[model samples]
Target chain A: MNFFRKQSLSRWLIHLWFIIFSVFCLIPLVYVISISFSTESDLAVDGYRLIPKTFTTFAYKYLLKSPDQLITGYTVSVTVTVLGTVLSLLITAMLAYVLSRKDFRGANKLSFFIFFTLLFNGGLVPWYILIKKYLFIGDSIFALILPYVIMPWHVLLMKGFLSEIPLALIESAKIDGAKEWRIFWQIVLPIAKPAMATVGLFIAFVYWNDWWLAMLYIDNEKLIPLQYMLYRIMNNIQYLSSSIRPGTVNIDISQFPNETARMAIAVMAAGPILVVFPFFQKYFVKGLTVGAVKE
Target chain B: MSYQTKIHNSQPLANMNVKKKNTFWREFLRHKGLLALAAPGLLFVLIFNYAPMLGLVLAFKDFNFRKGIWGSDWVGLDNFKFFFTSDAAWQVTRNTIFLNFIFILLTNVVAIAFALMLFELSRRAVKLFQTTLFFPYFLSWVVVSYVTYALLNPQMGVINQLLTQFGFHEVNWYMEAKYWPVILSLAYLWKNVGYSTLIFYTGLMSIDKSLYEAASIDGASKWQQVRSISIPLLSPLITLITLLQVGKIFYSDFGMFYFLTADSGALYATTDVIDTYVFRALRVSGDTSMATAIGLYQSLVGFVLVVTVNYIVRRFNKDNAIF
Candidate 1:
């Protein structure tokens, strides 16, 4: 509480305690990275040592050598994430723009209709049956991207963000005879870039992190997203080693870097995002905090 | 309140009906473009959110897939009865609620403590700690499951290796049920606590700093300020978050339970929850109706629990109410 006065031991202790936690935080990731780069024998023998006794990309080599599944997984994940984020943002921003407008008739009810989904839902089976039977999107690429492309909560957050833009901007544009979509694209979208970026990042993350849909709808290898593919690979390791599904990969257990392969699969699945995660962290924190407060 | 009055109030003019009709048509016509723009999203929510809600009716049907949902023989409450009559009703319910109870409590304490510690730091220090802490928040649960496996793998796990070094026997973490409650919780905390901590930190920052400054002026110790000013102000946010989580207590994080254990049936005693239970049950029977029945029960119970909790919070503390 005192800026000028020093609280010697307590200050030192506080810093010490947090630094310890930071280390605790780093261990899992570091351990993961360490094992990912370790050779199979080293991983199996030394058993999750912080530093690998022998370092090799033996598993990565095998992973890359026969790369159909990995390529399929990556392509599906990237396509889904890109398309889902862009389309979702456009839809969310447009809807939020309409909802933010003070003069839109029944805006309150419409917003409530969207918001109601946040509090209640049809649950998994009904939703699954709807998509499977009616929407006819089960086991398709759209299946991976559609379910989460627009969320009601994100719409409300965008409305909150968009509402803060001065109404005169829209009013003046309307007086100039700009169409609804034009005004939304040119005037509203530019001003709401920060909010768009925030929402865009959120949407991208959801698409990237999602495996639930992949689990539910996808049975085809080509259609599988990376996360679920990694999920299959992990389980396949369990199954293959148990001889439940023989010769699925055509590699014996001891031959490939099996232990490191699972870890490596995880690393590769998350690797791209981790590379750029730091640049986006500050905005993510801000966006999530504001969203939480608003909720 | 005022809208209700306007709707019910009678007009004196004979032309009032014509005027009202004109206004309704005029307003509707004026908003046509806006409605057109909103139509797609409205449709999306209608199909995705509203249409599925209609499927809750499946709980009362026998669900013959070849015969279609409507053609399925109606079995009023039979599906629900079948679910509730089993041992699964108790087991999954207990596991779901128990895990959520532990998660809500532990995650809250850690987040708050971290938030408080974060508040005491310099701005640069805060950013550094936040970046490190939140790194894991970005990783998917599948990735996290491997990290858990790496640390808990009986023969190759870091923890087991450490135990062996110290002359303790290895822990067969996958086979063991007793340890998963803690293991799963710790895995969850490591992955999720960062984001929630940041949420609490933001709440902490919003506290009228004047309260703290004034308390310090009155020669209040740091602990006193935290106890009186910080904790009390944060209570509303705390309750809001807790109740939000409580609303979903019937639903467990499928990724957490499923992947962390690698679907090890050996550990289901401590780890299984409603989502997993339903999933496993569906796998065995391919019974869409049964799954829907369980889902409806879960959703209804959670909806009621949250509504009741929210109502009580609103009654006592109007400012903290979620709605």
Candidate 2:
């Protein structure tokens, strides 16, 4: 009876700890969301709050009033993410499928060729110059899409998934005179749907969340993605805040809805992924766990 | 008679050469479809990955805008000397290694602990906790910076408001270099720990329940079962993740360091890392040659570390070795 009590106590303790930590994880996001919904005057007076004293859509309304930049950012981000994800998935799956075939000559060598990139690269300079100078891809959509298209890590993850299908499955198809491409399309792809979703979501996230490529290659305002847009807005805010004198009492930062609007932009930029990911959480967990353990 | 013998010997030798060539060609014809499937990706990799590798030679060249990579004047060791002699070199290098070491150590310990705790829960409870815990991981560092700003904003930030309420002096979180190491680590954990916790939880789930039952039957406590069965089994994974992180200690997550600090020049003392430093040198300072040199240094050291660590891992567990 004492042992049972002790075990239950510990279990309850775990529950309590997780609840607290989970709250800790969520507080920042909750605070930001709350501030985004609150009016600028309330924010200035109350600072940031987990719950707003008064709720208004003033910030979001302000953002929507001049939604040209926001619209362009959304359109570009969505276009690149969708295009990049599909193309990356196809390319990665094909390469991985080839390497997954034990019967294929040079499979091991080719696998090593892909894996070596994960270990080392020429670093940022050559890569930047190659795309910018040699390829002339700067300020283009391809600049964003091309660089991340054949991520070595994703290729390997897909390879790990693909190699698990039985060789006899492919052999029987080959016996029926199905070509390698046909076998890959007809037999392999349908079975690899879960892995595809997992890897595709990951690739999509990379394309969507990325600002690094844009920062380096993009100088055109029209080409900026959502994250980079958010980055710019935040950058300006930081500059504004830092440039002000510490002792100035008369300057009201909130007179312009910039503070609340920045948070709203952030919320909008990050909102879609947060909303979409929960539905795919199971596959996300499976992919990450399997990838970690298997690798 | 000699002429006839020479002709006879040469005839079979010529046939043998043709046969050897035919075998290779036949094999190529057979695998042509597979090669076709791989070609697009192979081409991309060659351009994006391999081309830059060849372009590492730019590290030794004085980059002239009008002159291309091939036509640039060779200035052997000068770019490297520029990087090594700079004061930023030691600072960034030390910060990268030290901070990554702390992050790996702190986050993994916390993750493992959390994973163990969750291992004690029921399925429904685990699901609920996981949903909330993993929420932060989806936010980009750019967004997280906004969240960070809301807290650390000098005047009207929440922490400052709270500090004044408690009769303590408000902290200027952004300007203070001393606070960033802790702040960054906490931010790192907030965004990352859940992913790793779930990983460790998955690892823990794979452990045989029969062992725990058998231990309990022998009067072992839950703690004993964990220490004896769980930790020992989980060590392989923990070691693998740690060693993998150690391999990339030279590279910081540029997004985190860049966005969270908002590239503040004030906090560069503690927060500047090799990656951010390289970016600033290349873009902000327009010192392409020096940046390339630093990049080369990072890549070579990173490669050696990864290869060495992989070798060490392979010595014990072949499957665990990344290569």
Candidate 3:
């Protein structure tokens, strides 16, 4: 819409600005992926080279020496992401559907009740104590799943989507003698597919990127998630060398995947998520567009 | 709703209006299935969210587990006093507010500028740039910490190597506290700019295209159009976003600060915020009480800030107020 001449100085300057910033934004990923493939000797010799001087699989090989931790971490993360996304989507959609109903007398009250949670909160220690002591879900997988399942912001966004579906459709379905459950499953759910895909990706990403819950709640080695494991290793390399899983033989510090292996592990931890990014790119933008629309 | 039963029965409105008193009850029974479906989620929020607002009382107590939450001795204002009186109090408060202020201002300007820039590009170029820019937002901070380490590592980091090539001595980025403020701000901008860019872009897209055409016909230059139309129209949404940001002034992005710094105590002077401080109090010092106290302080101030800003917005422009 900036209808300046094709060869204008501002056009070239803006293009240069965006091109530079895009590269700057990508450098973290480029550097990490590059170092992950670099030979340990080359990394030590060159010190964070942009492209690997001598590419090798040695870092990944050494990092996988104790395959149990990596496998368990992935297993925990994938399992939780799958289960958590489904549960969160169902609960959020149902609650939003109810709020979307113009006929439901409690809709306004319920909306305010849910939205109020976003403003005020019980401080972390109390919430922590609630889950850890009162609920007794401590060290269990439920600790990770329960806290995030009812995100109010997602509920509000889903309501916006549902509200856009013509009210007459729901009324017509009900007048045809369909049950509420049938109407929701057959009529509403299919119409709201785009919204579901967007929120599903959002919830899945939340479950994937979480390390805080695992750090706070679980002490069990079997339950450690990928991000927390990456965090421990990256925070201190010595932890990687020692028995990350107790009851296993302790490795000497010198043989640890001390440098290259650490970066390699970071790459592996983020591997599946990054590969899935392009697939969900459209849906993610749609979700943000939903927010912009509501505004 | 059962209030519409007369319509289904093909009866007159006079007949149904007499029985309107029972409408709510009958409607409740009629929609029992939907109500049942919504119960679990309602219960979940009740237990997790609203229930904890009561636990803010732990901020006043000694937090003895044996005594339990209700049974603990009341030590009113002691914890709050301790938080404000602590030596690290002012520094942490300043860091939290200052960092958040800078992020709010910087992300808005950069995101809006980038959004305007995206508007000037071809469709293919916009898509390509959008993906690359959004990539970092998906990465976990733990991975990013290693990325930061690669760039800032004392001996073999890319920055040091670049310095050496320029005929200057290498600078140790981690040990120094001064460099972290700039680095952390840059990191925050990198992770968030893509999301904000999308928002601003959507806002720009929603504007009627014919307006720009009409402006050009009237001999309005590009800058004039942007200043008169784009900035004026977008300012309300921008202010709303800025107010939402101001609400979180007392909070910090824990992962960004904790992970990217690699938990180097040397840099804590410039980097630590209230959230990290509370986390350290909980983990390292094993003082849950102190942690809860600081949390209550942060939440109270934040809650007040959000409500007050929202009230001000509502008074002026009812359409833009969040609540």
Candidate 4:
């Protein structure tokens, strides 16, 4: 009876610790969300409050008033994400299916060809020159999507998932006079939906979060994605205050909500993706399981 | 020969002949739809990945704006000499390797602990906790930088505000090089603990439940069961993660260093790493050749590191080696 009581006490303590740790992970995010809605004056006075002492959307309002740049950034990010995901999924699935086949000649060679790139690469300068010279992808949307598509890791994951599908299905389809194309498209793709969603979400996230390619190949202000634009805005603000004079006389540097604006841009940039993440978490878990366990 | 025997033999031989006549091109054309499916991905890798590989020659050339990459004059080892001779080389390399070593050790320890704790929770609670914990992984470094600034900013920052409120002097965190190694590690842990936890959790889940059941029957305490059963089963995964990290020890997380430090020169002593050092040398100083040289050095070292590590791992356990 005493031992039973002690066990229950330990269980309660474990629960308490779990709750505390969860709060630790979540509170900072909650703080950012609340501050995004707080008035600038209240923020300055209160420092960072858990709850908004005085609520206002002025930071968002300022951003919305000059919404052209923000909207363009959003459009570029969205287009790149969508196109990149679809293209990446298609390629990953096809190559995965081909490589998964038992009798496919050169499958091992092709796999190695894909895998070698993950370990060794030419590094940044050469890669930058390649994109600029051979691909001619500078200052374009392709600059964002082209570099990220078909990661070797994702291909390996997709291949592992495809390998799990029974070989009998392919053999039976072939016996029925079904072409390899028809067999793959009709049979293989349908079964690989979970893997596709997982790989697609990952590819989409990479494209959405990317600023590296933009930093390297993209210099035109109009072509900037949201993250890169936010990066530039931060740098631009610093430049304006220290280096360049604003072209207009009426604009006062002191009135600008630099701190609040930085937070607001962060909220705008990350908000939609965070909203979509939970829905995709299931697929992500499945995808990660295959990749992590196999590798 | 008997008629039935001859007919059976000829039928099997005819099938083999048909299979042999199916050439590579014919089989490839037969799978044209699959080829079409592969086209976009192949094109993407071709344009982005493979094309970049061809540009590696630029490291040996003086990049003249008028002459371009191929048209430029060959500079031989001058670029490499500039890189090796510079003071930045040793500092950046040391910083990269040292910081990465600390991160690998610390992150693995915490992640393993978190995973163990997670296994103790009930199913419903585990789901809730995981979602919350994994939230930070989705955020970019830029956003994470803001979170850091909110805490560390000199004037109205929360840390400073709290310090002054406690009757302590507020330190200028941005100007101090000493605080960054700790701060950067904390930031890295906060952003990544969830990912490592998830990986470790998956490893835990894969362990056969029967082993734990048998251990309990053998009069084992929870701690004993974990120590004997769980830790042993998790060793391979732990090794795998560590080995992969070791391969990239020469490279730094550029976003973490660049954004969190806010590119302040004051923090360069403790924080400047190979990637950031090269960025400063190339973009800021307009020394493209030196940057290329440093980049080449990093790549070569990273490649050799991975190969050496993989070889060592293969010696211990062939199955776990990445190759």
DockQ value of candidate 1: 0.56
Candidate 4 local lDDT, B219-289, one digit each (tens) = 89889988999887887778777766786787788888988888878888999999998888767887766
Q: Itemize residue pairs with steric clashes in candidate 2.
A: none
Best TM-score among the predictions, by candidate number? 2
RMSD (CA, angstroms), candidate 3? 5.6
How well is each residue in A1-295 modelled by candidate 1, as lDDT tens digits?
A: 4554566556677788888999998898889888878887766556677887787877788788888888998999999999999988888878877787777656776777887676678888888878888788999999998888679868876886777778888889889999877888798888887778878877887898889999988888788889998888788877655554433553344454467767777889999887777677656444543433342
Tens-place lDDT per residue, model 2, B1-323, is: 46545655779766666666665566656789998999999988899998998888889999876797788999999999888898998999999999998999999999999999999999889888988888787778999999998889777888899999999998878779999999999999999998889878978887889999999999998889889999988887787777667878899999999999989888999999999999998989888888888988998998889888879888988766766
Which pairs of residues clash in candidate 4, taking residues 3 or more apart in a chain or in different chains?
A: none
lDDT of 2 by residue, A1-295 (tens): 9878988998998999899998888888898999889888887887888898899888899999999999999999999999999999999999989988877766777888887787788899999989999998899999999999999878877887788788999999999999999999999999988779888988998899999999999999899999999999888866776677666654567765688888899999999998888777776545554443243
lDDT of 1: 0.81
lDDT of 3 by residue, A1-295 (tens): 3444543677778778888988888876788888888876676667778889988888888878789999999999998999999999999999889888888886777888887776667767888888888898999999878899999888887886787778899999988998888988999999888789878887888899899999999999999999999998875663343225433653333344467787888888888878887887665444554434232
Per-prediction TM-score, please? 0.90, 0.91, 0.89, 0.88
Point out the higher-scoring one by DockQ: 2 or 4: 2
Please give the RMSD of candidate 1 to the true structure.
Answer: 4.3
In model 2, chain B matches the true chain B with a TM-score of 0.86
